[model samples]
Target: MSYLKCSGMCQLIGGLLLLLLAGCSAGESKFLAGNLNAVNHTSAAINHFSVNGYGGGNVSPFGDGGGMCCVMLPRQWLPGLKLKVEWETDPNPNVRLPALGTDAYRAAYAKHKANYQQHSTIVDLPSYETESLCSLKVHFLSCNQIKLTTACMAYGQPGYPIKEPQVMKEPAVCPK
Candidate 1:
């Protein structure tokens, strides 16, 4: 049978071209949208949080909240993938506000609002590989630390990493 042949340099260039095509195609591939969940391990309750502007619902202290609509993720894991997380915390969940438009309401609202805080940070997303699902799991920790995970598994099952306390009460004070 007839055969094709090339010089060593030509063969190297050909291989490199193939690799370049693969890399470029991977870059062009569209990111898949996935659900988002938030886990709050800190003392404060999370009123809301977002990853790159995709909203995740409220979460109680030491507990997880329900899933949100979506967060976009790559079809495959890429190095240095990061997400900007923004979250609002409720320092006093049980605070009661006075009637609106009243002088007492204005004073109470301002004082109460002072305890609420919003935090933002950039966190690198961990590696995940799954064609069926690519959910973003957010974990809010003490001292304002955060972790993001992607997985198909549920929160409490095996192979899931977050293991928050089941019966712990929210602490009276939250650390800065």
Candidate 2:
């Protein structure tokens, strides 16, 4: 009877340890699976705006060899991933509805430019994991409609790099 009790206790402890190990491995795998799809989607969206008399540009990622999985032990448990996107339109040939002259267009352009600058600065600061920054600069060149220039950046992740601004046919709209 003593021998049987000891065996059962050992077996229970071993099973618990195995269960714990499995849980840890699962968590690590989840962390390894970063948001690559999100990056691809962003790239596609930027590419879509490449045409239509718009210029697009992007920046490369920080490190090489794709995105790092477990940069730090704590990261393995709680990954510190980030994605930042910024966009702006040119002031020439305003696209806003009801084209406004040089002065009005310039004012609107300045406003948007300031807004973009502010957003860019804000994103640079440390914040939450999942955050986005989008800015739109629309100029009214005609009675109704405006021209747009968009710029974006995707950073923090290993594989994903900041993308160049794409010439979107439509006005710049930030992704949700």
Candidate 3:
């Protein structure tokens, strides 16, 4: 019985070590590539390429390394998505991950408020950004937008409003 316990402990330690080793051996510079398209107020479609998935955080400045969340536009005049990326290391900081006023959240909150109103109980209302793009566009939707909100609200993950990757204003060790 003692031998079995010892072997089990050893196996657990070995598994943990292997996981650590794999993490270390895997380099940190992984890229996330995608294409983004947006229709402007004029009803013209614009396309942009996106990259820069690693090394984003609160400390990442606007022009240093990749941002925690950045969305670059391919053209100089194309409008980008309106998003807020927030994170907290604290055990409890009351930051609304999907910041107030997301379309999905609003819809949910509206339903919740309606149910509460029927009961005559005053549930605290959620605050939201009135100027969000949803207010301007009648029909704009993306599966990612909702998914991102759910992930952030549930897991406190940060969002990266990345622009399409572009040539570095200054060149250095760029890919050929």
Candidate 4:
């Protein structure tokens, strides 16, 4: 009887210790990942965007692209969290791709490449209200401005925190 009692007590203590460890181990990541969404508010087109090496879809001006799955974020928001954003944009969104493996393709490709521009910056993540993250929304604004939101609601939905204008204004002079 005493042996059985001791075993039960030991098991309970061990279980309690494990729970304590798990709670503290939530360091840096309890890791809830969500879909990546690109929202564009510029006259140009966002060819691509990435958050800390996680690739997302392209978006058109005043529009949003399809969601890209699985951008890992800490389950709980911590102050001062930031991410590196790298993106490519095209001034002319309507450019047609020339047929591959031809002389026209090479020349057109060069021109297309010349028209494209790249941007990279470290952006502070906007605060979120919930532990359950919905999407990592990357907003590309005019004059090479970028904003990030992990808001639980979708863009343009009621109570979605990222405010947008009816008609976006592009900058007359962009920074070099």
Better of 1 and 3 by lDDT: 1
Superposition-based RMSD of candidate 3 using all C-alpha atoms, in angstroms:
20.6
What are the runs in model 1 whose C-alpha is more than 4 Å off? 1-29, 99-102, 164-176
The C-alpha stretches of model 4 lying farther than 4 A from their native spots are 1-29, 96-101, 174-176
Candidate 2 segments exceeding 4 Å error = 1-6, 28-121, 124-176
Tens-place lDDT digits, model 3, residues 27-134: 643322222222111111111112222223221111121222333222212234333322211211222444477887787556544432100111111222322211
RMSD in Å for all candidates: 9.8, 16.9, 20.6, 5.9
lDDT of 2 by residue, 1-176 (tens): 67556577799999999999999877633221221111121111111111122222421111111221212111222334332333332322223532466777778766654532111111121222432223222221211222322123333334423332232233365333
Which runs of model 3 end up more than 4 angstroms from their true locations? Answer: 1-4, 12-26, 32-41, 44-176
The number of the candidate with the highest TM-score is: 4
Pairs that collide in candidate 4 are: none
Cα lDDT computed for each candidate against the true fold: 0.81, 0.30, 0.27, 0.83
Q: Evaluate residue 143 in candidate 3 and report its C-alpha lDDT on the 0 to 100 scale.
A: 15
Best by lDDT: 4
lDDT of 3 at 132: 24
lDDT of 1 at 38: 79
What's the CA error at residue 73 for candidate 1, in Å?
Answer: 0.8
lDDT of 2 at 164: 26
Model 4, total clashes:
0
Name the better of 2 and 3 by lDDT. 2
